[model samples]
Target: MGPTGTGKSDLGVALARELDGEVVNADSMQFYRGMDIGTAKLAPEERGGVAHHLLDVLEVTEEASVALYQEQARAAIDAVLARGRVPILVGGSGLYVRAALDRLEFPGTDPRARAEIEEDLARRGRSALLAELREVDPESAERVADDRRLVRALEVHRITGRPFTSFMPRREYVRPAVQIGLGGPRGALNERLARRVDRMVERGLPEEVARLDAVGLRRGRTASRALGYRQFLEVLDGLSTVEAAAEATTTATRRLAKRQVTWFSADPRVEWTDFREPPEEQLRRALRRIAEAG
Candidate 1:
């Protein structure tokens, strides 16, 4: 696992090929159908004949639930293990990755309280609710930069009568496995992301968004918020130009990469290697670490 555009997907396929494993996607955006180009999902030919599970399992209009994802992803991993093939969980969605591998439990949601919070958010604005969250759960408030996540944090605190950070993941894994992180400096990652966004635009991200918009992409609470997709949707709506959308997408993607790095780096168990390392060297190191871990 690693930040976006850090070659995690390519390395995942390579590792699966070497170990006779299957790839189980942990990226939240890749879960939705018709979001291929924007999410950088690998085409079938690009998969190098390694079977992948949990990609394209959701409609663009559907919401993604980490709790549900935990159930399905774990089942897929268990099946792969039972068949004597390794399961390589891949992607940079840190929470989804943790939900699939860690001993983490999602707190039950209270719709009534959540709706009330939503009302408050619409009425009093995110700053008001965020101030309240700061008083109750400052750690979560600091960590969650978005209003939507802040709202959820406030809702969780209200319902469970607990600090939102109480649900922060522990370092313990729920299964016997090794986590390999692709690490590089921040400047390098930002440059990579800018190039990636440029490639996405050249590859018809705007056209893809137009197609998805006709299919109810706007209704998807999760899919609608995807980085490039959201920005390009504004382009289609005449709210922004292609250049503006590209700029926004690149900026948002860089921020996401930083968050992913922070989230994965906090876990002491993850074995990290330089992103610039040769794939052969990285693979050998990963295999050695897995052997040692076992």
Candidate 2:
């Protein structure tokens, strides 16, 4: 897996073709229908006859849960393995990728407890909750900078009496698998991401967002906040210009790429290849790594 525009999708398809594998999408945004252009979703014809799973499975209005995704993706992987085809999990969503492959357990949600915590969060604000989290799960509180995540950590701690980081992914994979990471320098990735954003707008990202608006994309907590879509939605609402939106999208995407890099880099087991490497070489390296891993 790699940052956006780092050519992970192309590599995934190439590797799948070589290994007789089906592709499993781990990108969160690609889960929605009609989010194609904005998400840079590969067209069916572009998939090279390699069956792809877990794309277009969710409505734009629905919230995406990593726990639910874990179950569905694992089942897909099992089915692919049963058919004697490898399953290539591909995406820049580090958490979803980890959820699918790592032996990570999600804490059960408590609506009543969650409602209460959310109410407290709204009233007391993040500073107060962050202070409490520091008292309980200091590690997670320190690592998680957002108010939403801080609330979840505190809620999980209150419900389970365990540190929030307890649910964090370990390096070990639950299945026999190999993780290949694509790496590039920060400056190069930023330039690539800027060009990609420009390409997305030229490819009708604004029109795609307009179409999805009828399907309740704005109501989707997760979908609405997606990188390019949100900025373009503002463009539609007359709150921003196409130029401003594209610039915002580029900036946000660069930040996202940095985060994805940091997240995947933490896993010592990942075999990384430079993004500048030839595709055929990377494919041979991935195959070799998989064989060695086996």
Top lDDT model: 1
Q: Residue-pair clashes per candidate, as listed?
A: 0, 0
Candidate 1 lDDT by residue in tens digits, 1-294: 988988888889999999999999999999999999999999999999999999999999999999999999999999999999999999999989999998887888888999999999999997898889989998898888887798789989998999988987777889887999998999988998899999999999999999999999999999999999999999998999999999999999999998889888988888998888898888888888888988
Give me candidate 2's TM-score against the actual structure: 0.88
> What TM-score against the true fold does each predicted structure earn?
0.84, 0.88
lDDT tens readout by residue for model 2, 83-200? 9999999999988999999899999878888888889989998788888888988899789877778778877988999998998778788977889999889998898889899998
What lDDT is obtained when candidate 1 is compared to the true structure?
0.92
**Worst 10-residue stretch by lDDT in candidate 1?**
168-177
The superposed Cα distance between candidate 1 and the true structure at residue 153, in angstroms, equals 8.0
Each prediction's RMSD to truth: 4.0, 2.9
lDDT of 2 at 56: 99
